[model samples]
Target: MKRNKRKSDEMFNLDDIKVYMQMSAKDKLYWLERVAKFLHKITPSKNKKIWERLKERGF
Candidate 1:
């Protein structure tokens, strides 16, 4: 059975891509950090090197 996806999962359509492309540098940085943090959280404990890299980048 497929799980229901969140709105974030559906945010990569053309309109959203346009909006992302039009975002200011600061806005882009903000979103980038958010994505990095999210990835860091879900990363496996076995990947300590990956986690450290994210931390070094201030994620």
Candidate 2:
């Protein structure tokens, strides 16, 4: 029998949670803020519809 290996993208480890749990309160908040900013940058804005309409009219 052969064993299967997980690809890097498909691999997940619980050690990350353990490390997070051991972080200081200040460190945790700092990481939280960083994550929030990252998410905000990746997300689209609420004015998407207006942009779409303008593009459709050759703007």
Model 2 local distance difference test score = 0.75
Off by over 4 Å in 2: 1-12, 47-59
Q: Indicate the residue-level lDDT of 24 in model 2.
A: 94
Candidate 1 residue pairs in clash (backbone atoms < 3 Å): none
Model 1 Cα shift for residue 55 (angstroms)? 15
lDDT (10s digit) by residue, model 2, range 1-59: 12355557866445666678889999999989999898778768866667779999999
- To one decimal, what is the Cα RMSD in angstroms of model 2 from the true structure? 10.8
Q: Write the per-residue lDDT of candidate 1 for residues 1-59, one digit (tens) a residue.
A: 12344477675466666678889999989989998999889888879787689999999
TM-score of each: 0.57, 0.57
